[model samples]
Target: MKIHSIEAGNFKLDGGAMFGVVPKSLWQRTNPADSNNMIDMAARCLLVENGDRLTLIDTGMGNKQSEKFFGYYFMDHIYDLDSSLKKAGFSRDDITDVFLTHLHFDHCGGVIEKKKNDFYEPAFANSTFWTNKEHWKWAIEPNAREKASFLTENIKPIEESGQLNFIKQNSSFATQNEMDFDILFVDGHTEKMMIPHITIGDKTFVYMADLLPTAGHIPIPYVMGYDTRPLLTLDEKSKFLNEAATKGYYLILEHDPNNEIITVKHTEKGVRLDKSLTFNDLFN
Candidate 1:
């Protein structure tokens, strides 16, 4: 299997919200904010090329939303989903699976597109969109805290297109094993967020979804405020990061603007960042 880093684009989010309870003085040292107190973030996705099947993880914030809706996030970047795929020598039709980490607009909005007169439809007609069943139910029937992030235009179209598939719990599925690897699911960010764990070449890489958005978030307490269950997030993060450090797993960051992947090392101060490396650099 081959892995490609598909950069959808860049967007700005409030540094305060991204850092949660961490003070600006702390987080700013790593992810410095602009004059507007907004930090740069990347809508990075991973592509898996295995034989005739191509799997894409987390489509970026799509262009289907209205200008007013798009203005809020400041989606300003030259890279986009289609353009990136073209650069990778592939097209939307090549995608056999769309593995969503969660239904947040930034993560899954690109799954569907808005046509003339604002009609929404599936963006990838040939792909069987994969999302965990538990998360699907929670998102379609969203609570007040997350309703804004779960847009119907981005979701309903997949189900309507008859391409939606669910990953069964406690059992393996074809897509999960497509990479010749396993995926890790965790709640707290959103229900059943899928994190792909793969043995690429000789190294093990974990796609760090919103679970740890940036390398600056390695300090354990630096979870995003947007999380629905902050307390559960804290617990989940502690356990995951500790194991990641002990096992020397490389974390492939999704939202980090600068850093892409890093490995952790345990220290007296608790779990901490060790070394940063790009995935392609592994070939050398």
Candidate 2:
């Protein structure tokens, strides 16, 4: 199996929101912010090429929203989905599956596109969109807290196209016959957020998703403000970090612009980052 780090795009978000109640004085040291208190974020998706199955995990926020809506997030188009896919020697049509970590706009928005008539459709015509059944229900009937992040244009089109499929939820870790990797479901970030663990030979690469958005969020208390259940996130992160450190897992950060992959170690201050690595550092 071969894994590729797909750069969807980059954007800026309020540092306060990203790091929750953590003081700017602390988080700013790792993820420095600008005058407006906004920090850099990347929509770093992952692509898995196992045999004939080419799975694209998470699509970045696409350019379908209104300019006014986009102005709020300061979207950068330097490394968009199309260009990144081409650079990796593939195209959207080549993707056989799209495994969404959640229905959040930034993670699943690129799966659909708006046409001239303002009709939204699935962008990857030949791919099957994957999401868990629990998340599918939660997103369609979103609560007030997360309604803004779950956009109708970004999600409804997949089911309407008759290409949407749900990976059955059997346990904390579930395996689908069509997928080459195992999925670990966590609920702190959102309802049934799926984190994929792809194993290649002796190494296991775990997609961090929002569970651990950046390298800076490695500390125990550094939970995001967006999470509905912050305490649950704390517990989830604690258990995952311990296992990741003990087993030596290479964590792929989804929103960190600087460090793509990171390894954590057990330090006196709990689990801390041991090394920061770029995609080529390990793969090349």
User: What local lDDT does model 1 show for residue 147?
Assistant: 97
Writing each residue's lDDT as its tens digit, candidate 1 over 1-284 gives: 77888999899999999999999999999999999999999999988888788889999998888788778888886789998898789999899989888999999989999888878888898898988889999999999989999988887887888999898765543444444457778888988888878775567888888999999988878889999888889998999999999888989899997888899999999999898888667643
Candidate 1 displacement at residue 47 in angstroms: 0.3
Report the lDDT of model 2 for residue 84: 89
RMSD of each: 1.5, 1.8
Model 2 stretches astray by more than 4 angstroms: 171-180
10 residues in a row with least lDDT, candidate 2: 171-180
Alpha-carbon lDDT of model 1: 0.87
Q: Give the Cα lDDT of each candidate.
A: 0.87, 0.91
**Model 1 TM:** 0.96
Quote each prediction's TM-score.
0.96, 0.96
> What does candidate 2's lDDT look like per residue over 110-206, in tens digits?
9999998999988899998999899999999999999999998888888899999889776433233434477889999899999888877788899
Deviating ranges (above 4 Å) for candidate 1: 173-178
